[model samples]
Target: MADDSLFAQGMATRRAVLGDAHVDNATARTTEFDADFQTFITEGAWGSVWSRPGLSKRERSLVTLALLAGLGHEEEFAMHVRATLNTGATPADIKEALLHVAVYAGVPAANSAFKIAKQELAKRQEAAQ
Candidate 1:
């Protein structure tokens, strides 16, 4: 773990944002081939980007949602939708983000994201109940 403060911070942030169960599942599923990929995201995405103080976690959450939507990353988008609870992004915020996605990224991406978001939201609601 030399020269790996970012990785450590990223790992902690990832766990907090994604939850212990989700992080554990990801770790458990990591194979030799993809281990490096996971490490890079952990350090770069979680540590360097997410840990930055420039943007609040809530704001980052919304931006991430839009980007994921725009890029058609359905599974990742849904997982992030679930992360909103920890990041403090409300449903209204997500709705508004998707609106931006529709305008800038186009209707199709936002449309599909909305469907995925709805399903994930429903699942969260059900789990809460």
Candidate 2:
């Protein structure tokens, strides 16, 4: 975004959803060539859209999971699933979302997403203990 304030808002929203640790890792790994891309998503996706008031972050998390699963973005889907820690998406919500993916996105996409989601969820649960 052209406006620094808007970009800052995006950064905050992104961090809120993705968690500071994940965002920090992404930032640390950003190269000069990809820095522009980072800024664009931070401003456009996280800042402008995610910062909007229309949808709660929890609902956004469900929609994001469905979109990512349907798009076959397994990695991004898994990342967003991890983001559920902050987004308040329950395991049941993820299961329901994946069921939607199975119907619309096909069973294969849902299968992969379920595998990743289960693994990530297990990791989080184990870490919590």
Candidate 3:
């Protein structure tokens, strides 16, 4: 079925972008109530949008960071910040995106995003040590 194939593709892309461990943990936590929501995000966000060819994963990652920060999606912004390693989005890239978020979204949103980003990036640095 088309939906099945799309879900498969979405899973692959999601794993690629978010990494297996992250995807596995999310899959493990899925419940009946949120199962459909998970599938929808996988199929719609990962398969349909992320899988598109016009933008590289890095570009997509930066854009996603900015949007999440702009909209004050703290948890998701943090998750995506962690995902930057797999997405090839450098810290510099994140800084630039957050700057854009400040101008377009608001200083308060960007300020919160910057704080979260700093914490995430610091955690990454500590992990590498």
Winner by TM-score: 3
Off by over 4 Å in 3: none
Give the number of the best model, judged by lDDT. Answer: 3
- State the C-alpha lDDT per candidate: 0.93, 0.93, 0.95
Could you give me the TM-score of model 3 versus the true structure? 0.97
TM-score (C-alpha) between model 2 and the true structure: 0.96
Which sections of candidate 2 miss by over 4 Å? none
For residues 1-129, could you state the per-residue lDDT of candidate 1 as single tens digits?
A: 323898899999998888889999999999989988988999999999999999998999999999999999999999999999999999999999999999999999999999998998899889999
The residue pairs that clash in candidate 3, if any, are: none
Q: Record all residue pairs in model 2 with backbone atoms less than 3 Å apart, i.e. clashing.
A: 10-47
Q: Per-residue alpha-carbon lDDT of model 3 for 1-129, expressed as tens digits?
A: 239988999999999999999999999999989999999999999999999999999999999999999999999999999999998999999999999999999999999999999999999999999
2-55: candidate 2 lDDT, tens digit per residue: 568878999999999999999999999999899889999988999899999999
